[model samples]
Target: MSDNITSNNPSLEDVIAEAVRSGLALVHTSLPGVVVSYDSSTQLAMVQPIVRFRRRSTSTGSLETYIPPPIPNVPVVWPAAAGGALTLGMVPGDQGQLMWAERSTDEWRKTGAADCDPRDTRRHDYGDAVFVPGGRGADDPLPADAYHATATVLYGATDVLLGDSTATDKVALEPDVQGQLDALAAVFNAWIVVPNDGGGALKAALGVLTAGGWPTITGATKVKAK
Candidate 1:
């Protein structure tokens, strides 16, 4: 008997379709409380989760430490407007201090116990830091191996529509929504993974939806419910 196992018959299209379908199904099964939709006319799939943020505040005589409300549920899609033109790239693990540079123009001028001496200025640069828990000296640049790649996805109009309502409309939209979600998850899994370098993957994923004839995503400004 031959050791090889052969199916009676299978078409290439069937195999490819099954693969895509299986990938989408796996993602849906893994993430709960999330709604997915697909628009066949546009060939787009959308994934979103219901989330709420509560305003919270506390006063301490002179200083206040404010922490934004936690995201109760992970959003199915990250909004593009929240962070302009998302890019995925590698950064040193110890470069967390530099990440805030985009938030403030004078970030380097801010004084802290870590920034004491004028000659010590060289020590504050990202190159001077070590990613390890503890290291010998400040001049020892951390290994580039400590770097990591980040993944980002821009949000579309569909996400905004889903976030605005949690009504029966959501249920009505479920079937289409789920289709999109499955498509997105399929593309994401195939392309987005560890070790960084996901730009190509993201582009491919977005292309799948755009080519499908979905509405051009636009006007993503945040809105408050009346």
Candidate 2:
């Protein structure tokens, strides 16, 4: 009446055949398959402990004993001297430092992207996100003469510059860039003009940010009130 040869229980011959088949299957199978998915047709399921049985001698056979390959050095887009003196540029060890405008006589004036601390004048580093072309790596070489539409010191809008006066024949940055810089000035000047409180700070910062007048800080870096 039933399709199974042993409806109530598996006979001794069926048990022996299954054991032999499982033993043979173990020889040519991955470790995951054996450990993760093991289902027997029998009602009484018996889970076997994984054993370290190697047929051939090898230096590193087990996963725990395996040695991974070393990681390669990642590349970056660094600024270099291009027919001019060093300015607004990132050199060997200049990681968390940048130069931007501050309304001071010696704050910022486009020279060269490779320039560092130009003319004994110190520029304030804004904690906002900045975007300048020409940090391209070996795979991506900078064009003979390239220029970016907007250039603002990042993490914050403390200063703004076009990287180089040669980028375009303009004294200032793009209109939107100029507006953000102005908004930054307004926000900063509010402290000088108005009282340095929550209301004043938010009014200035949000005005610029909401109107797409602020440089973005992508990645894990978070923006906070200065």
Candidate 3:
């Protein structure tokens, strides 16, 4: 029997349930290396293992430098069974911007005292470092130490399992899934990065999704093994 389902019709939960069942078959056939598991309540398919990125830092001058801190190990989770895609939500500090300074000398002549040229100096910003404003909350207008950014890539077999056939169908679904993942990642990032202020953007996004007929996955009962 075919497990394909439409995103607009049979609710997200139903779609995900069917997709998880169908996804196992696809995973078995196409990507044998990846291990697949599911979380019933959250409707999340926990793809086994995690991915990591290398971190490095650079120094521009004595007091100024670029420190690219280590990015944490990320877990890949499918947002929803049907309409959503996998997301590796990473809250990376020091990846966004860099700050630096340079020194310059200026000459001055004294009126009477031995005609001295005072070696005056000034600091300058250079390269991408100039883009980052110094001090806390100085460059980023959001009044937070960190901001949320996301990277999304499509899940090919999952799209096909969701009834995406043509090139256009597959392409069309990519952005939609990517947008949803981005929204969720933003919310997760906000919760971690800006804990002081209430997450207004994340709340608003949830409100919009709730209003738009998106249902929340609540319990393990909803999950089924393929």
Clashes of each: 14, 14, 1
lDDT of 3 by residue, 103-167 (tens): 32122112424354445443441211111111223453543323445644232222222332122
Residue 190 of model 2: what lDDT?
57
State which candidate, 1 or 2, has the greater TM-score. Answer: 1
List, residue by residue over 1-226, the lDDT tens digit for candidate 1: 2211124464666567656644543231111112234332332223222232222123321222332222121211222464342211211221211011112222233453444434442322222211111122356664554444674433332333333443122222445656666776777777755456657667866787768864323322432121
Q: What's every prediction's RMSD, in angstroms? A: 32.0, 27.1, 32.9
- Provide the lowest-lDDT 10-residue window in model 3: 125-134
lDDT of candidates 1 onward, in order? 0.34, 0.34, 0.34
lDDT of 2 by residue, 72-189 (tens): 1111213444564323323332232112233222322234244445454323322111222233335555343333457532432222233443343223335656665676776666
Q: Looking at candidate 2, what is the lDDT of residue 94?
A: 21
Off by over 4 Å in 2: 1-176, 192-226
Candidate 1 backbone clash number: 14
Report how far off residue 85 is in candidate 3 (Å): 30
List runs of model 3 lying over 4 Å from the truth: 1-172, 192-208, 212-226
